[model samples]
Target: MTDFPQKARAAEAAMRAVFDATPLMRNDHLSGLHGADIWLKREDLTPVRSYKIRGAFNAMRKVLDADPSQDVFVCASAGNHAQGVAWNCRHFGTRGVIFMPVTTPQQKIDKTRMFGGDHVEVRLVGDYFDQTLAAAQDHCAEVGAHFLSPFDDEDVIEGQASVAVEMLAQMDGAPDVVILPVGGGGLSAGVLSYFRDVSPETEFWFVEPEGGASLTAALAAGAPVTLPKVDTFVDGASVARIGARTFARLSGVPRERVLLAPEDRICVTILSVLNVEGIVLEPAGALAVDVLEALRPQIAGKRVVCVTSGGNFDFERLPEVKERAQRFAGLKKYFLLRLPQRPGALRDFLDMLGPDDDIARFEYLKKSARNFGTVLIGIETKDAAAFPALFAKMDAAGFAYRDITSDETVAEFVL
Candidate 1:
């Protein structure tokens, strides 16, 4: 009954009032793919469709027990945190003032409202989250309201530890390896703390979006360092800086265990879990699972548990997710080629197609040569190795081309 385990058990007890334990089901698909016993701690099924609710619920509960009549709780978030806070306010019969960036998606805003109902009021302010956060803090100060943070709070970290408590019980014991995604570090920190106390033998694999690998960067530098720019593709786990208190708990962890999941690779995993396993996960939620491919050798025969952080996925982005996945796996490609205008030239090029290759997109820009035209083509194929053969045929046929499928700058503008 160390302090860490005590805190986690208390956190788990508090959460039972809102929602029972989320499922910790063994995933057959993942298990077969990785050659290991794979299980998923489905935090995605939490009340706010994320693990954020644990922190929000525990923090608010503590506040209420102290005063029993705290009026308004203020928070600034346009993602899962906002929804979690709103839901907690409603549950506690307290008022919530949420400040969101004006650019926040209608889906998120609508969900937050739906969760909080009349217990919450949303203020759309600022163009970016930083601005909205500042506004929310100032307002809370002026009104004497408690400004709850998404992370960066010791109480919230303790609240998040509840996930580990449920995981241990649900799994019937400790897992050999626990894959946790690191955002602002509240969930990872809390889970790590709980394991430190009770299951020190368990290994940890900390995952983060490659575009925003704050924990990885900090480990490399031997201290926290700010990222120049962060990609918000994995919004839940994309943090420019790790929490100070959280980094303190996790600072001594081995750097080799921290993994960076590429954004496009994550999109592929998200789509795979959705289609193959009938499980929907946000980009961040898939981070831990996606790293399994990267750590196949290490986890080959071990019992592994990956935290599926959240499922607040917007289905409207499915097409984009598929497009990204195809690009990353080399199942799709874009090329700019020189095409001759001669009568038999187009027919000659068409004859070079491989059996598995499919033309997904084709367009012609202005002719670049007197007797030739610049043609932009998009190709899809069954395998990545098919491209080299396709290119060989195109070269032997005397057609010149450049592959631009992986050129981010070029892809952004033309593709």
Candidate 2:
């Protein structure tokens, strides 16, 4: 364990053969927002658009050096890790069999294929990641190929520690606080282990998506336990269970230091950074930055570092991201209204709306003989406070409506 820092430094040195160190630059925009000296460690700018490449490169390099004749590698990933492994397989001129869940986005699949070219074969297996992982392990055993665990392997963890090595070397000294995004925990574990050995005084905070709080669950249980379900919206950081090896290193983390970033709230950060700073970040990539507001009290007047984990966002999901952001901000809502079937009913309803309210969607379900109709409507407004006045006007006019914005069942069907 004493020589771990030496080994990590050596790995950092070897990474130069592949790509230069990602930037650790002060973010003026975020600094102003939180009143803190906020710096961004741009792991999103890597060749694979993520820090996953660091671990993949280190693990594959060590394997090939130890056994030059080894030619095959296998891994299961939904996105970033597969690309990292694919990119490294091409660099090392080895065959890689990559497995991904059938539901993975076509953009990710294409990107992985583009990175590996002739050196990789992609297999679309089970609908869920767990099933895909099982298939990958079975295939690996049958072919006698090395199976690469994304976060559990020792070499991968050491490779990930390179981020910490580069960070400390690039900055004047250890930061007052270092916030990291957590998925299966490889990046956090590696960074924590290295930082603890060299800069023991630095404070650390971990962020996980609210829908997939694997680390939080582990801390409470005193061990890694699989979650019955996980939301995949933050695909890069949505793990059902924290890795066993990673949990061993991170078990000491206090519950307070592990923050949960709600999925919709994260969408707000994603769009804010993209529009204001002209920086693109995926859901998981924005986790660390999304929590800065919550920690403003503690981080103000201090030097803080936030790791932007990945930038491999599909632009096709932009609309969904915008909608989520609006919803979370209370700037948009959906409602089911019961309206009189008489003429000029919609006009009367429109008149009740404030100057800033705009109807984004309006549809009448059916007109009944009872002189009333069911209408589906979506409203967008500049301020959340506008809703109260609008509802007051509706009540005075004897208008009946149901706010379906938070009803998941109705939303899934109508929205």
Best by TM-score: 2
How well is each residue in 191-259 modelled by candidate 2, as lDDT tens digits?
Answer: 999999999999999999999999999999999999888998999999999999999999999999999
TM-scores for all predictions: 0.96, 0.98
TM-score of 1: 0.96
Error of 2 at 180 (Å): 0.4
Q: By summed lDDT, which 10 consecutive residues of candidate 2 come out lowest?
A: 362-371
Off by over 4 Å in 1: 367-370
| Alpha-carbon shift of residue 60 in model 1 (angstroms) | 1.0
Q: What do the candidate models score in CA lDDT, each in turn? A: 0.91, 0.94
lDDT string, candidate 1, 1-415, tens digits: 4687897788789789899899999998899999999999999998889999999998898888898867899999989999999999989999999999999889999999999999999999999878999999999989999989898888899999999999888876789999999999999999999998899999999998999999988888888888999998888888888888888888998998888889999999998999899999999999999999889999999999999999999998888899899999989999998887789876787788888989998898864557788888999999999999889999887898999998989878888
Query: How many residue pairs collide in each prediction?
Result: 0, 0
Q: Candidate 2 at 185: error in angstroms?
A: 0.2
Colliding pairs, model 1 = none
